[model samples]
Structure formats: C-alpha cells, structure tokens
Target: ASARKKKGDSASSTTPPTPTPPTTVVAAPRLSAAAKGDKTDESDKGSDDDNDDNNDETVKAGSESDKDDDD
Candidate 1:
C-alpha cells in the first residue's frame, strides 16, 4: 500500500500542470460624436447660432476698427 501510494504521488508530481486560459479583455464599443450628445441636430443648431452671433460681434468690431483707420 505504501509503495503504491508513493508511485501514484510520483506520477502526479511528474505530470505538468494544466495551463490557464488567456485573459480576454473585451473593450466597450466607442460612442459616436452624435451618440455622445455633441453632434445632435438641436445642439449643433444652437452652437451654430451662438457662433454666428459671436462672428457678427467680431465683424462689427472689425468694421469699427476699419472706420477708425479710415478717419
């Protein structure tokens, strides 16, 4: 009995250990600019209007400067 147990133990110890499965890191899908709430129609229109207003103000200032230069 003792010799049989020793042989079994030696057989198990000689065998290589099973390899673990590789860790798969799956990333989440990337959100589009519209999905992220940046390029939506409402937001884009609002921003475009704000940009147009800012550009008008800048043009007015530029025209004033031009008038000053002309004077």
Candidate 2:
C-alpha cells in the first residue's frame, strides 16, 4: 500500500502541465492606396525582368533564322 501510494505520487508529479492554445496571430492587413501601389510596383519589376529575358531569346532566335536564310 505504501509503494502504490508512492508510485501514484510520482506519476502525478511527473505529469506535464496542460498546454495552452497558442494566441491567435493575424497578419497585418494592407488597406492603404500607397501600400497597394507598392505591391503593384514590385509585381511590375518582376514582369519587366521576365519581358527582358523573353526579348533576349526572341532576338537570338531571329538572328539564327537570318543566318539560316543567308546560307
């Protein structure tokens, strides 16, 4: 009976505390025109880079076709 009581006490002492649910974290919402403009500006920069790469490929292809025509 003493051993059983000791074992029960140890089990209860070793048990972990109940975990609390994490605080709800929300992203800062964008609601201003300037903030919207900033996003548009960033997107435009990406598209411009893509356009430049595509233009370079098209020019290379055009030059290669011209060389073929010459031959």
Candidate 2 residue 25 Cα shift, in angstroms, is 14
Q: Cα miss at 43, model 2 (Å)? A: 3.6
Give every collision pair in model 2: none
Kindly list the per-residue Cα lDDT of model 2 for residues 10-70, writing each as its tens digit.
Answer: 8776653322222111222334566778978988897999899999999999999999999
Residue-level lDDT tens digits of model 1 in 19-64? 2222221122234543566657677788989999999999999999
Which ten-residue region of model 2 has the weakest summed lDDT? 18-27
Candidate 2 stretches with Cα past 4 Å from truth are 1-41
Per-prediction tally of clashes: 0, 0
